[model samples]
Target: MIKTSFISKTVSELKPSGIRRFFDLAANMEGVISLGVGEPDFVTSWSVREAAILSLEQGHTSYTANAGLLELRREIADYMHKSFEVTYNPADEIIVTVGASQAIDIALRATVSPGEEVLIVEPSFVSYAPLVMLAGGIAKTIQTANENEFKLMPQQLEEAITPNTKAIMLCSPNNPTGTQLGKEDLIKLSQIVKKHDLLVISDEIYSELAYDESYTSMAAIEEMRERTIVINGFSKGFAMTGWRLGFVCAPADIASAMLKIHQYTMMCASTMAQYAALEALKNGGSDVEEMRSSYRRRRNYIVKSFNEIGLDCHTPGGAFYAFPSIRLTGLSSEEFAEKLLMEEKVAVVPGNVFGDSGEGHIRCSYATSMDQLQEAVKRIGRFIEKYKVE
Candidate 1:
C-alpha cells in the first residue's frame, strides 16, 4: 500500500481556496444570496452556444492544433491588435489554454526556476501565489493599499525586487479589488521591469468589463511586448465561463516554451469551446457590450449602496466586484463574512483570505441580479447597524 504521505510537499501544504470554501457553504443553504463567486451569473449568449452546437452537429469534435485552431489564434491576434493595440503573430505567438487560470500556471512554470522569486501584487487573486510555488519559485508579495486604489506602485515594485526576483505576476481590473492600472502607471512600472530584466504574466481577463476608460494592456507599452505574457479569455468578457477556453499571447520563444508544457498537460483547449470562441471573437462584441453595460450599472448601484451603508467601498473601475472596508464592525474580514452569512443569509468573501492587505475588507460581487444586490445590501446594512461597535 502506498502511503498518502507520499504526496508532494508543495501540493500537500497548499491551502484550499477560501473562495471555494465559502461558496460551498452557500451552495447548501437555501435562500442565501451569494455575492462570493467571481463568475458572471449571466448565461452564455445563445448565438455563441449555438455555434458550439453547430460544430458538434458538423462532427467538428476532435483535437485542435496543440497551439489551438489557427483560425482562432488568428482571430485572437486580430482582436488584440484592433482592441488593445497589442500585436502578436498567431502562428507561433499564441497558444490556446484550458482557462486563463492554466495560462497563468504554465507561464509561471515555464519561466521560474527553483529558488527564483516572483513578486506578486497582493490583494490579488488567490491563485497567483500558489501557482508561483507550484512553479518552484518563491512568492514574495508587495501589498497594495486603498490610498493607491490598490494599483501597484512603482516604489512598491522597486522595493520588492531583489537579485533573486525573476518575474512579476500582475492582474489589472484586479480580483478582490476592481481597480486597474492606467497607462502612466504602466509606463512607470514597465521602466522598472525593464531595468530589472523581469518577466510579466499580465492577466487582463476583466479588460472588456472596464467602465469609463478603456482597459490598458501592459503588453501595449513600448518595449514591454516581449516581456509581457497576456492572458485573456471568453469567460469574463463574453459570459462564457463554463466554456473553459483561454489563450496566452507572448513572445515567440516564451509562447513556444509555454506550448511545450501545455501540450503535455492540456494538449489543447476544448474543441467545441474553441469553435465557440472563434465565433465569439468574430461576432460577440454586442453581447459583451450588453453584459458589460449591465455590470457597470450594477457597479454604480452597489458602490453607492455600500457607501450609504457605511462600508466605505471603493468604486471599481472594472470587473464585477466591490471591496468594502468592514472595519467599523470591529470584526476581522473573516468574522464579518461568517456572521453576515450566518445571520443575514448573504455570502461574500473575506478580504483577508486574499492577502493581509485585504484584512479590513470584504469582497461583494455584483454579477448577480440587481434584485439580489439590493436585498444583499439591505441585509448587510441592517446587520452592520445592529452589530457594529462604532
Candidate 2:
C-alpha cells in the first residue's frame, strides 16, 4: 500500500478545482442545463480541422523544433503583429505551448525562484495560484471588487507589492468576471511594474472577444515589450479549445528560459495541432468574427435577463460570461448554486470559488446555445424568486 506522505506536500495540499464540483454534480443528473464550464461551445472551424487532417495524411508525425515549427511560428508572429502591433521574433522570442495554460505554467517556472511571490489579480482564473505554487513560488492573490468592474487599479498594484514580490499575473477579459483592462489602465500598471521591477504575465487569451472596445496588449505599451510576457491561444477566440494550442511571446532571455522548460516537460506542442493553428492564423479570421458576434448577442441577452430577474449582473465587457451578484437573495454563493442545481436543474459556478471577494456572486457562462442559455436563465429566475428574502 502506498503511503499518502510519499506524495509531494505541495501536490497534496492543493485544493481541487471548484468549477469541476458543480460540473461533476450536473454530469450525474438528467435535464441539467450547465453554464459552468468556460470552454467555447463552437466547434473548431472546418478549415483548421481540415489542415490537421491533411497533416496527418502527409505523415508529418515527427516533431519539429522544440520551440515549434518555424513556419507556424512565423505565421503566429505575423498574426501578433497584425492583431496587437507587437512584434516577436519567431526564432528566439516565441514558444508554442500545449495551451495558454501550459504557457502560463512554464513562464512561472522559468521566472519565479523558490520563496518568491507572484501577485495574482483575483477573482481571476483558478489555475494561476496553483501553477505559481507548483513552480515553488508563493501565491499572493490580490482581490479586486465589482465596484471597479474587477479591473486591478494602480493603487491596488502599488499596495500589494513587497520585497519578495517577483511577478504579477494579469488576465484581461478575465475568466469569471469578463471585465477587461483598458489601454490607460495598462499604462498605469506598466508604470508600477517599471517602478517595482516586477515581471508581468499578461494572459490575453480573450483578446479577440472584446465587444465595446478594442482589446489592447500590455506588451504593446511603451518599454513594456521587454518586461511583459504575453500568453495567448486559439482556445477562446478561435473556438479551438480541444486542439490544445497556445503560445507565449516574450523577450529573448525569458523566452529562452520558458523554452528550456517546454523542451523537457512538453517537448513541443502536438504537430497536427500546430498545423491546425497555422491554418487558424491564416484563414480563421472570418470564423472567429462569426462566433464573436454570436457570443456578443448571447452576452447582451443573458446580462439583460439576469438584471431583469433581480440577479444584478454587470454587463461583461468581453468573453462569454455574465457574473451576477447573488447577495440580494441572502444566500451564500455556494448555497445558491447548489440549491439552484438540485431544485432547478441548472448549473452555474459559485463565484466565491474564484476568490473571497466573489462570495456573493455567481458566474454564468453564455457560451451555450441561445436556447440553452434562455432555458438556464429562466430556471435561474424561478430559483431566485422562490428564494427571495423579504
TM-score of model 1 (CA atoms): 0.99
The CA lDDT of each predicted structure is: 0.93, 0.93
User: Candidate 1: where is the Cα deviation over 4 Å?
Assistant: none
Off by over 4 Å in 2: none
Query: Which ten residues in a row are the worst by lDDT in model 2?
Result: 311-320
* Cα TM-score per model: 0.99, 0.99
Clashes of 2: 0
Please write out the lDDT profile of model 1 over residues 179-259, one tens digit for every residue: 988889899999999999999999999999899797789999999999999999889998889899989999999999999
TM-score (C-alpha, index-matched) for candidate 2: 0.99
Task: Give the C-alpha miss distance for residue 79 in model 2, angstroms.
Answer: 0.7
Clashes of each: 0, 0
